[model samples]
Target: MKLDNLYIKDDTRNPTLSFKDRASAVGIAKAKELKKDVIVASSTGNAASSISGFAASAGIKNYIFVPKTAPEAKVTQLLVFGSTVFLVDGTYDEAFELCFKAAERFGWYNRSCAINPYLVEGKKTVAFEILEQLNFKVPDYVVMAVGDGCSISGAYKGFVEFYKLGLVDKIPKMIGVQSEKSNPVTRAFNKNTYEFDYIPPTTIADSISVGIPRNGIKALKAVAESGGFMIDVSDEEIIESIRILASNSGIFGEPAGVTGFAGVRKLKKLGLLKKEDIVVTVVTGSGLKDLKTAQ
Candidate 1:
């Protein structure tokens, strides 16, 4: 793809090696402010690992629930961070429900991205950074992989906030990418509906394999209100993007992390992206987080 200016907002460089760290940082901080001692969350991998790492540094107790299929590397990170890990013998959605109930029962602060409003506050900082780094010049498009939809919504919120404050003239079109094998949001957008039915996801991009997106409404609004569209890419495309991004840009990312780049490629091939358009694709996680899949 020969776009005029395509930038990669590489969140893989975060402390916990994923974009989830931004949310986790805020979640942890909120828990401390609330005087909560224990925090709980459910994730495919990144969120659990991120919160666990931050909680460790903050001396806060954390309980993480992940599906049995969660990548071993992430599980190891959770354990290493001293979190009480629950490997739910079911899908991520099941794990999420269980974690939610557990949090309520135990009175632990829930840090799951979709359920917590404050987490998005931290995630929105990505938009601020992108604008600041580019000397406040807004890009034509901002793309990222959508999991539970919280990250994309956060980004939209950030841009909107900046616009409200007259810090920027316009907000970029927010493009949300999903795996073809697990694309409820894309399906909903294509159908022009806001309500999305649960479609059990079976994608190799574990981080984005959400069947029932908790923040689906906000994500759909982000795409629609910003004059953006949702797109789904094949797993093969995502894997290939990992290689392409690394070989060309020296940026190594996991499958889900590179999904946005894959979408950018697809968009260009489909004639949706103009050659003169400035685009930024957010690489949300490090390849090291899922070494086996990357290999």
Candidate 2:
């Protein structure tokens, strides 16, 4: 198993400065093809910003509803990129719900996670890129942060579909990370079911502090089907991992992005991960999005 640490598709080469660009690329293309004018979304940070920037590229008007608690740096991107931004009065989940209601009531095309199947379809390209970058080699483990689970589900689906296409040898065990306070996915994974109430909110990984994970069932299945596992990290660990990653690998990752490393560390401590194991941990967004956390 070849361990390739350098990010290719997840690299910061996208114009919008985030991995969500992969999904936004497809979303904007499809929305343009469908002739949708107004695009609406809700995000804690990167997802909405990505779509907002991409919508601008497509000459489509963007409406973003983000939690007031999301980092100012992220909100700044939306406005600077020329998208209309709304600061929701509640949590990210509340913000997402408001966006969902607006999409239904105002007939806005929702590009939000899980709520839109198209976005998931777009986000799934990460797995395809990983496959191609690896020269059709599937890693022993795939680690990532879990937000609304659209990207996780999308990437997992890509692997499943790729196997069907005879493009990949097998699917990797997918390990998803969530903030300790908002680890419904991890809770469900440990409890061996999807019916769990663990969404209390968190501070470290804002992008993934999902109270009630939208794609709970599918997200759980993605791990199980991939012969993978799930884990959680405290805000402190997530923060420390940022500096650790930057110091060791020169990869400056935000708290959300650092969750993958947190998972790697925790798995390593538990002796669940082998040193020879080919592990690919996805750093989802640029650390610059939340400079305070990294500092």
Q: Which one wins on lDDT?
A: 1
TM-score of model 1 vs. true structure: 0.99
Task: Give one digit per residue, the lDDT tens place, for model 1 in 94-172.
Answer: 9999999999988889999888889989999999999999999999999989988999999999999999999999999
Model 2, span 1-295: residue lDDT tens? 2233423234445676677887788778878888989999888888888998899877999899998988888999999889999999988889889999999999888887677767777767888888888888788888888876776777899889999998877888888888776788888899898786854686667888778777778888898888887888788889888888778777777788778778788878878776677777788877888988776
- Model 2 — which ten-residue stretch has the worst lDDT? 1-10
TM-scores, all models, native as reference? 0.99, 0.94
lDDT (0 to 1) per candidate: 0.94, 0.81
After TM-score superposition, the amount by which residue 131's alpha carbon in candidate 1 deviates from its true location, in angstroms, is: 0.4
Candidate 1: the clashing residue pairs are none
Runs in model 2 deviating more than 4 A are 1-9
